[model samples]
Target: MGGLSSEENASSKSTSILLQIVEHSDGSVSRPFVPISAPSDDRPDATVLSKDVPLNPTHNTWLRIYRPSVLPLATKLPVVIYFHGGGFVVFSAASTFYHGLCEAMTGAISALVVSLEYRLAPEHRLPAAYEDAVETVLWIQSQARDPAAGEPWLVRHGDFSRCFLMGSSSGANMAYHAGLLATALELLPLQLLGLILHQPYFGGVERTPSEIRSEDDPILPLQANDTLWRLALPKGAERDHEFCNPVVAVPPELRHLPRCLVKGCEGDPLVDRQREFVRMLEREGASVVARVDQGGFHSVELLDPIRADSLFSEVRRFICNDL
Candidate 1:
């Protein structure tokens, strides 16, 4: 949650040094800023009991399930399939920051949360993550058909009929693409209720006003954003690739998507793109609710407890009541 140090801040104004990368001899790179895997918490007093399982063992893709510690008396809870944000390169389902965020979401929304750990970039780029997302949904659909076929927690407590796709940052991008696939293919019996995109990561060749102004942003500097996208998209693809910029080619499924919740922040460099996305969805006659906060940067919910709680409250309303 800490911002740039005084010295780093001074240096950042002159030259952005965020996300210092370390290249490995194995043709992979690393960002040494955030450590990985904080371990799943299943403490008795915890609001939710979490466990990880392989969604597709063959691909090293896995997911973490967050079930409410205290189940309701009669009703099965809504199912929220989530993707973590790491610019499509870093982080995992078990990462400390995302685990806490999902746990909070499970409690606040009173739903079953499944956080996906898709393969990262500089290794398994673009369509790989998008494919994993669709696979995740298919796996859930299989589990719903026969409770004994998959994870017992979901089989017992989840309401596949009231499902949602939610994510933050780059993860939100994955959710959007996957949502389109799900709607187009009509992955039935596993009803998709809505989409929740929190500061969706999108880019284009043109420099957005927010992006230009956030040159020295401590969390995500301009250089880091460009580098991540370069490593994520196809070998020669530009920022305007359909995967990076949703506005490039609006899919027919765009209007058919379920209700959507698009949340953006004024302080985020990608805020302009988020706003543009909302406008597009509205023009398509899609049911969309746009919330643009006057302050806060990208992934502010991750750093601020109050903001996180407020976000969860909004999500709870969106899922449990608003929709």
Candidate 2:
């Protein structure tokens, strides 16, 4: 009753409201895929131009890049390497929902957006997505080193020194882990300024109060969340694995990492865990900014345009001034 008002959920509900989990004999899982959005760069009316590039040719992973149509002569734009959320088991950079998201982000934040299409589970699992995330950053670094070899958008106007990682839901989880890995490696010339985690998906064997209150909610029910973790985490791993629960998993080296902005919604089942995560970040001596919406559900920005714009505004503030 306390989470996701009925009206809010109703606006997004459909025949596929509940994610029907199909567990495979090989320990993999499947779900109904949403409609995909293709990349575009020739639209004269559009403010942002988007195109896809191969990130890992061997693994079939690619990244979708979004940049403003008009170039800025005075200053290079900050780069935002983004990851889309689908509980690590669904969605892609090409998802219709995320395409619009990156486009809006590109225009509003005035930053070049690169949305990674990483390998998902139960096909890839855990560190696989995390591995791809770090690799994507490395690819960007390589591009920065050789402008001719990189996409003109990145080389011409993108600011490599002010790079940021932003992701939603499970993608946010990947951003956190990958940020840690990238920082530890000391990848030179390409600096990480900050991290943006939107309603991050974190869990544990024990339920938090928010999870309990929204166990039956249509949008991301507790059982659905557990199934996702089961299919995403390594086999035999519980929700307590470092990948699922960050409050207990932050590394000692995280003390000097880039600033982090963690945003959540009160109607989300994961809000309590996100709050605890923010506290943990503070306790660990990390610079953190936390914003919680008064009323909304998980990934509410994706469904509500006004909420999405509000989020974009906050992200703009964070990228332009806060960070």
Candidate 3:
């Protein structure tokens, strides 16, 4: 009654919005996933040069490359093939969050970064992104097998023999898959030195300790996680499908995968699955560096500067040590 009619105010308040992706008892209806594109080549560092180039014209698949402006003479740097996390539905390679992260990582590690822009799901679906991930590796292998076919940034200074696949969330799922393929296909003269997964995304139908406990936490919630699987997983695929939960069956042999560094958070609903994955890796005799942040929530590094610094510093240590 302060300035508006009581009936009008009541109607406005009642119609206020809630869930971004709504799921009814009968069927689910999700909002369209529109990505925010960051300015091209408008990165922070003056010395770091960045640009976007298409990998496949048919699918419009592309990647953003980042490198130092002034390289130390005769010094070959490690190559990092990075994939961004969005639950496989939202965000993109050109998003400002990944842009800043890649720039900082390139500067800190003194390495070449190639951020893959894989297709989002609920539109493209599971194996689509996985296929793109594999293709990116093949692209690198092609470049290494013949320098003329390589991207300028890589051909000039990247050390393909020491390449690493780094991803977070759903992208982590892709990184693990791509690593498995690298082992089987054998990209000669280009060795995959390591796999760095920041909060590796894996899930199952059965409730785990963290999943049962941490429902509806800020960054990743239980209901949201379910909806993501619904959208990300291929049509008719179950929660325990091999793509979502590798601990099940696909890729019967985990051998040939390089050492891995998996970062998880106790406060995250996904951490329990991450822990299980580490154990599976151990059983397979694969070397793993499990770094769990006490009381840390999911994707804290995406916003908090201090947390981002700590995450990147940990990543730097893993990469440098592997080299």
Please tell me which predicted candidate would have the highest TM-score against the true structure. 2
For model 1, the stretches where C-alpha displacement exceeds 4 angstroms are 1-18, 24-27, 36-42, 321-323
Tens digits of per-residue lDDT, candidate 3, 72-157, equal 79878888999988788777888777788887778877888899998877778888998899899888888887887667778879
- Per residue, candidate 2 scores C-alpha lDDT tens digits across 51-126 of 9989889889999999999878899999999999988998889989899889887898899999999998988988
Rank ordering of all candidates by lDDT, starting from the highest: 2, 1, 3
Better of 2 and 3 by TM-score: 2
RMSD (CA, Å), each prediction: 4.4, 4.1, 7.4
Candidate 1 clash pair list: none
Best by lDDT: 2
**TM-score of predicted structure 1:** 0.92
Clash number for each model: 0, 0, 0
Scanning candidate 1 in windows of ten residues, the lowest lDDT window is 1-10
lDDT of 1 at 62: 89
